[model samples]
Target: MIQYELQQVTQQYNGKTVLNIKKLEIESGKIYGLLGANGAGKTTLFNILSFLEAPASGQVVFAGQSVFFGRTELHKLRRRVVMVDQYPIMFTTTVFKNIEFGLKIRGMTKERRQAVIDEALDMVDLAAYRGASAAELSGGETQRLALARALALSPEVMLCDEPTANVDVENQAVIRALLTRVNLETRCTILFTSHDRLQAAGLADETVVLEKGELVDTSYENIFSCSLESKGKGQKICLLQQKIPFSLPGFVPEAEGRDYRVYLNPDKIKLVQGGQQVQQRRGVLFGTINLMMAEGEKVRLIVNAGVMVTVLLPVDEYAQLRLAIGDAVTLKLKPDAVEWL
Candidate 1:
């Protein structure tokens, strides 16, 4: 198992700053999700952390030791930590031989080598391809082959970059399943990057959002457990040390229909002036504005009532209303906005 700590990691390319992470820590035995928009330094950070590239400054501490530079120490770290690259290499050999490459390099005997190779193949469900040419495999199969090769080494930690990038839908599930099984059955820890939220939601214990190399936020289930769901209650919210309150008009009567489905158009919502619920209660409190825009001639808004409510409004109308960012207005949730959800 390996514990990696990075502080003030920064990188530059062609005079442009590529990454600037202030601090990050990875514990042993946990799967972490690193997500960001394209070109947000995801790959650059990955390269530096995996020891493939150098950082302008800062340090990476692994297992209580600081790794600054030098091939000797870098090679040592490379051997212990394996990265199944997005585009993996395949030597001109059979799949079995490719999987056995690391074992051979590590000087394992023939008996031990075969056992490790077989176990790795079985782990990835690639036993059937043992005799196939490594280069002839499909995109998804290639990724699996890459995993099998990495597994044969039985690394202390594995970093998978875009493992499912070129995979077919069916094979994507296969790869995820294989990765999950390996994480549970083996002692190796995994830190992977994924574009699929649903996949990350299920597989990752913690998801760290990266913006331009810095940690923007980390998602956790309990973060919102205490906040006012409607927040519209505004200053009325109590604090062992907080007080104040803003009264709002009564809730709109439910539209007679199936369930209301107030669609919160992220674009349509604007910060308005006056009657504005306190900034703290901003997320909730929905209402429609008079008239509409290039969009529907009319717009609607609805506030959800949980322990509080979730606010939603139409995009076009919100803009059409010409409402500034802190103004309060009435919400006319249509029959479509509310539902069992």
Candidate 2:
């Protein structure tokens, strides 16, 4: 029932454009990640959503009403959305008061505010530190304070900008688990950016990849499906172009379905140069062997742009060919030679 929509949002900084998001939408109760390298404009998009600054010009609709850059309307909207930044804000006040600041501003009763404060601190495992001074807490403790402060407000939408970046690896896992638990318990729409591949793969149900302010890929299942098939299989094998790319792209369910294996293992391929003109079933590439090392009966060679590859042949075959260093040799492979990664 939650909806946040934007169309053609752009931002400029230092004579250079930093953020350019076109037609983005988020539904409530889902954790969508904004994943990319450094300087990928993740922070800039967060600013746009918070109304700290508006786009050059675009349209935004939150919940059901249209939104503008005016301070009054933005202030009202800000109450429902909270931003927990990378670092916690220090006020030279007690942690208990910091968590209660939002509700106090809205003129809530003291009894209700105290209850909310206790709940927030308990959720972030900072209930014991509720009486501690905000200025004296460590880095990890400060981040939890920021998150607890936001959770105290009970915002409808929460945006965490690299909340675990400064924490240790073990603490990073704990933080991720906390975020996941928060999303499930509260059902608040969540969007976070992370450089951890495994974290993004495991945590986010939707992935939005940005390359220098441009989207390289957007689909969740298909993109990882591509990566699963691309790794370890692109070691120099040719596609038929006829069989795949027309229907399922390397997937041939009709040919064998379950009985036969569609992927071939590259390590099993054996090279033998014989025909003056190569046949259609065989592959041939001529390259000089820069170096050769023996591994029992198998041999490893560097050739064709210094590609390291292995070939297994009998010692008799090696002695017969008399293959040596700097010797010109032709390599052969077939479509069935390589296994799908």
Candidate 3:
């Protein structure tokens, strides 16, 4: 079932268009990672989804019904859909009271509210802090508390904006686990925004990337500012950081000397150690592996060759290469790896 459908959704702020999504469909009971940089219309889209603000132009369909901004019972819809902000606010009260307040507003009986609070706290692993003051909790714990408050209502949809952005590493892991557990156990639909490419790929079942207030048909990794330079014979070189160059067929007209952005899919890249017997190819890039992180069956490697580039490789392939951090490496971009954004 489709949870939310957006058509011709456009939002503007102070006469400047901020978001213009032509069509989007959010499926039910799935985790979607809204990937983008800051001010990529993520919060704007969230405002509309949470029904806090309506789009200037568009049709919003929720739960198989068209939503009319003023005509719809927005307050009621908000109860079924909750948003946890990047910096979650804490009530100047006990953790238990914080979770209890929302339930009380909905007229839940005392007994029912207590049970719900217990479950929500346990889900976020904040049961031990029930009597603790909400304002005194650590950043991560406070974030979990915000989630608990939302969970207490058993919302059908949860919107988390940079949930772990301000948390400690330990809390980040805990919060990630909690989200996965909640989705698996309760089957609630979740949409979260994150600038971390690996985190988004690891957590979300699907990823929606936004660039410059518009949706882009690619993941949000390996994006670089580039300019095209004509290299004779109807070929162009896309220069990154004015150093690394990617040769492309000059099929695009009026591209020379003009600024553009390019996206290199991590999965489409192959990394090899510096001394590997790889041909001096058009797409081969030299860099040093600055970081390597395990992502389930794949390993995400970050290489610094003037510009930071991300590459994804299967665990077996990574093991075969025997690469490590600080090792000089060569990234072989496949023929179709370079994408114009």
- The model with the greatest lDDT is 3
Q: Tell me the lDDT of model 1 at 101.
A: 88
C-alpha TM-scores of all predictions: 0.65, 0.64, 0.83
Instruction: Give lDDT tens digits, candidate 1, residues 1-341.
Output: 44788899899999888899898888877788777656768888888878888898888987779997688888888888888888888999999999888889888999999999998888778899889999999888899999999988888788888787778989888888877887788856787887654456556666766655677653211111121122332322311111122122223223222322122232333424234444534133433332222323443322222211223336664566566433345332232332221
Candidate with more favorable, higher TM-score: 1 or 3: 3
Which parts of model 2 are misplaced by more than 4 Å? 218-341
Q: What C-alpha lDDT, on a 0 to 100 scale, does residue 134 get in candidate 2?
A: 91
Q: How high is the CA lDDT of each candidate model? A: 0.64, 0.66, 0.87
Tens digits of per-residue lDDT, candidate 3, 140-223, equal: 888999999998889999999999889998999998988998899889999999998888877899999998889998879998
Model 2: which ten-residue window has the lowest total lDDT?
Answer: 220-229
Q: Write the per-residue lDDT of candidate 2 for residues 16-59, one digit (tens) a residue.
A: 88877787888888987877767778888888777677877678
- The better candidate by TM-score, 1 or 2, is 1
Worst 10 residues of 3 by lDDT: 246-255
- What's the true lDDT of residue 187 in model 1? 52
Task: Give the residue spans of candidate 3 off by over 4 A.
Answer: 225-260, 267-283, 289-301, 313-328, 333-336
Q: Candidate 2: lDDT of 156?
A: 87
Error of 1 at 213 (Å): 2.2
